[model samples]
Target: MGIELELHSERPTWTESEVWHTSRATLLRGSYEHGEALEQLLTRLGRDSPGGLGSVDRVGDTLFDEREAEAALREIPGLLRQCVHESQTVAVHDLATLLASCAATPGSHLWFMGD
Candidate 1:
């Protein structure tokens, strides 16, 4: 079945914005454990996989450097076009902005969590 999804960019975080957690999650369609598809896309692109980002144990250790995060965010639209398109409210641009904000601050990283 071709399920159609509408985007909603402003998704609430599972915890405080800057707080680090044991597992990484994102605000996608469902809730706290949403965004598997998005994660898959990242995996396919070699950015992140099922286990983690491949480069690091992103669960509790992932740290998004401002410069590096910016670079990675730039590639989101093109690299994960399907993910961007599926999100009816959460535009890729918006997500990038959120992630950028997290990256800009101290003790903050790009970890997704929502419920």
Candidate 2:
């Protein structure tokens, strides 16, 4: 099982299965084990943190609207700095880059899909 981060121009119209199979959205994937580490880090950061970083559901789905993406962008740098593992660093950076793109594109959303 793994997690996928997808960028959609608007709220996706496809069903979850269809989104996985057919959507041509920008995507980044990571192992579920890696996601667990990321989630632990987020937990340490506190769930109520302003950027909603702690709200990511690593075993389910989480969606970040453009405004939330903008807030997350502000927190990514700090998150990256706290990463001790190289894979964690890469994941955080990749997520940040994707979120930044989503934030800049009006109406875009970032989806964190886990399975």
Candidate 3:
């Protein structure tokens, strides 16, 4: 029983609220803390989501749409680099790799299924 974030469709097709309204996309699957952090990071970037990343309503909810996902994909690289300076964990490493893959894949939906 852990966090599970997976991009539903290969192409992010929405960017409404980070977690609230996906319309018909895959929701990011993760823990409350992950959503908290995502809210912080995304909010800093001026994204929508007044309520912040919501609790797991469904396993297949998509956090960001195409545009929002693109933005996140761009921002994560810097954060991933920062992980290098901090004390890293296996989880961190795995997440970094996964994010990198998502970043690399043009239409790749990154799902969090690390349980």
Give lDDT tens digits, candidate 3, residues 22-114: 624544333333433333333333324332222222334544334444444444454444343332233344444445555555656654322
lDDT of 1 by residue, 1-115 (tens): 1111112223224455653341323322322222444444444444443323333332332434445455566665554455644652344445556455654654444543321
RMSD of each: 9.2, 3.2, 9.0
Model 3 ranges with Cα > 4 A deviation: 5-60, 63-88, 113-115
Q: How many residue pairs clash in each candidate?
A: 10, 0, 16
Candidate 3 lowest-lDDT run of ten: 50-59
Rank the models by lDDT, top first.
Answer: 2, 3, 1
Q: Which tens-of-lDDT digit does each residue in 1-115 have in candidate 2?
A: 3556778787655686786554555343323335555664665677777798778776788888899999988888789889888877877877787788888888887887766
Among all windows of 10 consecutive residues in model 1, the one with the lowest summed lDDT is 1-10
TM-score of each: 0.43, 0.77, 0.35
* Model 2 global lDDT (CA atoms, 0 to 1): 0.73
Candidate 2's C-alpha runs over 4 A off are 21-40
Using lDDT as the yardstick, the better of models 1 and 3 is 3
Better by lDDT, candidate 3 or 2: 2
Instruction: Give the candidate order by descending TM-score.
Output: 2, 1, 3
